[model samples]
Target chain A: MNLLLQLFLSFFQIGLFSIGGGYAAMPLIQAQTVEIHKWLTPLEFADLVTIAEMTPGPIAINSATFVGMRVAGISGVLVATFGNVLPSVIIMLIFAKLYERYSEQTLMKHVLEGVRPTVVAAIFTAGLSLLNLAVGSISALDLFALAVFVAAFLFANSKKITLSPITLLLFGALGGIGWEALGF
Target chain B: MSGKPAIDLKFYLKLFWTTFTLSLFTFGGGFVIVSLMRKKMVDQYGWINDEEMMDFITIAQSSPGPIAVNASLMVGYHLAGIPGALISTLGTILPPMIILTFVSIGYQAVAENTWIKAAFHGMRAVVAAIVLQVTWALFKSLAEKKNILPLVLFAAAFVALFVFKVNIMVVMVAMILLSVVLSIHETKKENMS
Candidate 1:
């Protein structure tokens, strides 16, 4: 298969199969991009994940664009992004139409009520899996990193920065630099 | 322009620009963007009300694909139908594409630097903590809702994903089936009373 086509198909499958939103799509992405396709090394993946977090947008879209660009440059980015986004556009549009047309029908309401809790659970599981991966790998986790993690978590929850992702990541960069300077 | 009821170019541009600006800067995920969008699009501009935003958020969350795109699609559709959906999605994707294009091209140069490596190391571990915190917040909010089924389902979903390593599609399909069944049963019980 062509590399660009492969990139498109991979992300198309990813977007289509990514139930319960982007974070929940992480496992499948890892399986395809790293395990099956070897498009990236595990270490490269970790760095990409960091970049995704540090940058704006969801990890799935960010990774797809990054990987595609790495594979085939500008056209690759367009293909990968379109493939990743296609499913959401189609599905959400259909959903929006249906929902507007039939919101009062008890079935839709009940289905949604049931689905809501399930989604909450999935988000939790996604977060746990991310943490689990972090714990299992990464030999001798630095104490400075751990402190930064705690502080970041606190700052994230405390809403002290007035909700700026750049500000949050700037804190990470500066804090990390200081920690590295201290040899932690 | 005053009497023209149909939305024009200015409205489309505003929709595109609002989503473009929001997604270009916000991080974490769709959830973060959604909150910021609500503050701007909902509270500031009144493009959509709170309940509409909530509905869009829920649908966006439950559907397949990136929550960010799904969200922008839903909102755009609500505001201006199909064209709105396309334009909004275009806006949501542009920033990531542009940013990642440059990063992927230039990453090789910076990846080898010692300080950059150290910064990434610290950033990676901190990223984990941030995820854990999001999970904790999710759990607390869900718990506060006092929904037993979700709590139980949460455990079941975790075990299925972590312990069993089940395919997520399978888990989700099963959940949808289970939810429909439970809803039917609840309806029946209500009818009987």
Candidate 2:
């Protein structure tokens, strides 16, 4: 019972305070779930990040669902997902209603502009922190993982290769399975 | 609202079903689903014009939440109303909820298997890579504009977050306040000039 409340209130705070969409929310989510609640360790949080990507819909939805289920089962899924999305639902509803009226306001424009770079920085920090965990704690700088990372990173950023993210994730999984199966 | 079909059962069902399929299939981040939505809402149906679509995208992209959810809500509301928004949101979120439910339930058994463990280890790397890719794209977007404010803020934020280990929310709040001040100051200077 208390667990459900904790999940709801924590995610609600993360969702309400979070800006710049799902990816941008990673840092805050990590802090709330990993640092504050101790729901999962850093390495576990990294896995959650991967799972969030593998699933569909919003990053926040996937993540909150995963964390919720981990904490409280199906009901946990319901609470966490709702808690995280409640803000988006309400705010988006308001925006949907008044988009034309307030979108062009100077105050709004400045806030949006201000948020973009902060989001980027947060994303970078999250990625760096995750990578640091893999190197410093989880694995000993596995070449296969690094190779997969470089490949997927380039594929996503480069226009020429044109492979989908699922394909990239599939290949990464395959590479891991094969490497480990071979006793390497 | 201004130039679309009337709210009807068919419209609601179509909106719900289309987003359901898209959410079910779309893997990875919000960007992929967002593109599919543009195709469905703008190119295929012609429900919203290009300008209106662009507005929705801009506003949705910049707002809080997942890009797909935000975009769907905007499109759904534009097409119908509150109910439309709810249906579209349900469509977008339901698929993942079902899929992740299976994952969350079965994940413990899967995690214990060695081969699956290896695969997940690699998948972990991929997650980091995706974040790096997103970071690169975000930085590039700011670079293209050559705006001093964002660049400065980005540097300040990076330091505050990574080096000093400050709370991310604090840094973001400071940046928002700074931008608001800068904008107001610029407007004042322009008026004086």
- Chain A TM-scores, all candidates? 0.70, 0.86
Question: Candidate 1, residues B106-154: lDDT per residue as tens digits?
Answer: 7877988878876776666556666666667767876887769777877
lDDT, residue B84, candidate 2: 82
Best candidate (score: DockQ): 2
lDDT of the candidates, in the order given: 0.75, 0.80
- The candidate 1 chain B region of ten consecutive residues with least summed lDDT is B1-10
Give lDDT tens digits, candidate 2, residues A1-184. Answer: 4999999987877777666666877888898888889988888899878777767767677777888888888899999888887777898888776776852455566777878888898889999988776544454666777777787788878888877667777888898898898998
Residue B36 of model 2, lDDT score = 79
Please give the TM-score that candidate 2 achieves against the real structure. Answer: 0.89
